[model samples]
Target: MPSQRGSARRRQRGVLLAGIAILLLALVLAAVLASALTRGKKEESLEPLRWQGRGTTRNLREIVLGRCYGYLAERRAELGDKDCLKIWESLKDAFIHKNPCNATTEDYQPLMKLASHPIPCNKSLFWSKTNDLVHLYTKSSRRFLTLEDTFLGYMFDGISWCGDPSAPGINYESCPKWSECEGNPGSVFWKMASKMFAEAACGVVQVMLNGSIETGAFRSSSIFGSVEILNLNPDKVSEVQIWLMHDIGGPQSESCSGYSIKKLKNILEERNFKITCEDNYRPVQLLQCVHNPDHPDCSLCTNSTEAP
Candidate 1:
């Protein structure tokens, strides 16, 4: 009887150990499943940034055919075919199936050809690193027209787009950032567009440049610097006005007489285009003063400066 009881106790011990082992296995499986679920959630969170072109294409069409047409409705007679499907096609073809970072100006030749229009001479305004302020000034006063006012530029302003060579459409989420790729879709379009705008420049043209930047008001590598300035026809562009714009607050680092500005003036003069420089161009100063009347510079924002 003692031996049998000992045997029964041993059996009980074995069963208990087996149960513990099974429980541990279940716990491990639960942990693995939980880890997988967490990973899936993390991946799902990143979906928006990598959004493929299927949805973006539709939005692009809407921007080209919808919003842009409305903006150009008043001038439709001058810019024929409010229908922008062909223009959209040309733009897409320029980068589709091509490397996202390998698009060049020539790649956009077809699109440029389709979107070309005669900008009124002397009304053209170019800007570098001052897109927001320039647009606000132009939109409100309507004194100067910018590339952003054009149908092609208006549609894609502040937007990023690129194509995937492996995919058939735009890779909105993973498109290269500006300065990441020299021949990026956005860069190529702007290069071609700036060239055309500069070539069309007539009479006195205005360029709004930021003075606070360490790179100087005129950066030689900027689209305005490299493309626009080089393309400005000396015969058509009688004068090139440099609006060296500064902020209303303190920390003024650059001026119209800065080394960079002098280089820009020399370039224009060499091209036979009369150069003019205005420190804190009047209209821009007025806008800054309007924004910050309490600023110290606001009180001194008089148009007091020697002519170029």
Candidate 2:
């Protein structure tokens, strides 16, 4: 009887041990499932925000088409052969039904090819940190042409667009800012367009820089410094002319002899290109003086005889 009772107790202990082992296994499975769910939730939360800065601009298609027609109407002599509809389709296909942040220069090749045109030699003007002044100078003087003055740049200027893998394709709810991602649609388009503009440039190319920028006028990271300057064909481009202009009210932080300007000159020279640097180029300065006529620096001429 004693042996039988001992055997029975051993059997009960084995069953209890088995139950504990099963309970441990179940707990481990539950822990793993909970961890996986937590990870999934974390990933979902980290996805990029769908709505950025006013979403894609409204009437994107109409705006693009209108600009295309307007460009053809104005520059018929130069770009009369371009197919507007095809151009639009190429532009749309670039980012449609795709991730907005995945934009690449290759995606814009079709549009570039379709819209390609020759920039007149010695007429290319590149600007860095000088948007308003550069455009103003280009418009008022008509001596040079910037990218925005071209057909491709004009059509998409100030427009925002992106795509979704879902229905309707376009993300009309919002679009990423240029700073949000390197592959931003607008940023990619402009980088390619700038590159093309630089590659096609011949003779002397002009660059306008803002001298008042404390961070230095010729930033290597800027489109002009990074894209346009690097893409310029040394054989085709004879020289690079740098125009360092400062605001009329003063705060002149950089000059032709400054570190940034010298850096730009060195890069051009290294690439076997001649370079010329000018400070407060008179023509552009005169334009700046238009609004600040009372500013002392606006008096570019000391005597009546010096007035042009």
Candidate 3:
């Protein structure tokens, strides 16, 4: 009987040990799944790229007052009122305490009304995907004004903001990526702003397109193509100058005579606007040549004609 009891005890102990092992395995699996889920969420948050310190209202305010206020101060007299406080208030009112994904262009109408101004004739510059190069060139030369150079655009160019219905204010932690919704606040604002900027274009206007794109630089989905180009008034704007930017090295594909560009030209000409195209604008090429002097296309940098 004692031997029988010992064997039974051993069986019970083995079952307990097996149960514990199963529990531990389950825990490990759960942990691995949780970790994978967290990693996926993090990766998904990186969509619709934004600059640093751009997600929160507090950080955005600091940028507006500190960095952008200086830009506003330079033209305060012309700007009138110069109440950046009002601008901030209106901007936040458009998105805060609302659905992050449902924001529309109309949401920002109040801010636009407060910030709207007429851009000088022939000074308006439009670009498609060439954000970095266009901004760099425009900042260095006072010859043109891209949307960001404007008071409102300057204040919020690189910033990102969105709202939560459950939350009292902005959601700086995570917001629906811009591409996740057509009514994304950031994209809607820019599209509306681009429309206004294009509507304001007069005399000779310039468009800088990246020549490296094989599908063609002028995409109808782009802000320039979707909003700006359509809004341009043929009566006010006499000419559209296309600056096709290419890398310093030789694999240049799109040019003034490229099929895609010719389509763009035909569109402009149909609107009764004169079309002009330059292979590589001197200023932009010079910038590339400066950075990459040893490139084969550097010779063409100095030789290329400047935009008239």
Candidate 4:
């Protein structure tokens, strides 16, 4: 009986030892897995930012080349001796293989020079918070030209692009937003373009401001207010005419005599620019009435004695 009891005790000890070995093996496996997961996270964090905004426009090169060729074909007289291939190369070199947020205005100088064309005197139009209406008016009137009408702007008006340090250079997967960084490619390009456009303005220039903007029509931080207005040549640009237009229906929060307009006027006067402000300029209002003919505000010329 004593022998049998001792044998049972020995078996119990063996079973306990086997259980401990299994537990130790499981702990080793868990530690290895945890270490591997940590290493993976560290490597991922070391990779460059992929950016978070809209991806670079699909077929970016094709679109840019197409626009360049189209501009040359349509405006050969204005754009003399421009090499589209050189312009594309300059543009690509501005941001390619670099951090998307590191591109600066100076980097676009070559591209700007390659794509530069003189904006005719008295035809320069600037707009603030009235992008759609301003473009519509320009399209219909064909009297004035905005920055977007030029070759550089025409090529990249709504397109987005950025660069990566990885393969292919250009980040077709994603691009940074203007608000993401001060030196983002898009913001830098537009700033430099706006400055050049304003500097080229000669004789009287027109600015279209949105009267229905609740915060005010003239924002000091806007491209027109900051870059364009500040860069205008006082000697070449004789006058700055403002057309403050409200929406077709109601809520005309601002006007020619409002604080915003007054502020804009003061800025122009300080810069030696002859300023003229008109609320709901008749011509632009007429254009707006084209789409909203049933609106009461569209009855401007209804009582006219003249025949169409």
Can you give the TM-score per candidate against the true fold? 0.75, 0.81, 0.77, 0.83
lDDT by residue for model 4 (219-301), tens: 99999988999999998988989999999996899989999889998998999889998999898998899999999988897
Off by over 4 Å in 3: 1-58, 301-308
What residue runs in model 4 are displaced by over 4 Å at the alpha carbon?
Answer: 1-48, 306-308
Candidates' C-alpha lDDT: 0.78, 0.89, 0.81, 0.89
Count backbone overlaps in model 1.
2
**Which has the higher lDDT value, candidate number 2 or candidate number 3?**
2
Measured with C-alpha atoms, the lDDT of residue 276 in candidate 1 is 83
lDDT of 1 by residue, 1-308 (tens): 99999999999999999999999999999999999999898666544434222223446656666756676677788787654777778877887767767898778898777777888877989999888789889987888889888766776766666776544456655666566767777777888887887787798999998888886778898888888899988878788888888876755668889989988888888889888888887777888778888877887634567464
Q: What is the lDDT of candidate 4?
A: 0.89
Q: Tell me the tens digit of each residue's lDDT in model 2 across 209-265.
A: 999999899999989888999999998998888999998786899989999888988
Worst-scoring 10-residue span by lDDT in model 3: 46-55
Would you list the rank order by TM-score, best first? 4, 2, 3, 1
Question: Each model's RMSD to truth, in Å?
Answer: 9.1, 8.0, 10.3, 6.7
The TM-score measured for candidate 4 stands at 0.83
- In model 1, the Cα lDDT at residue 80 comes to 77
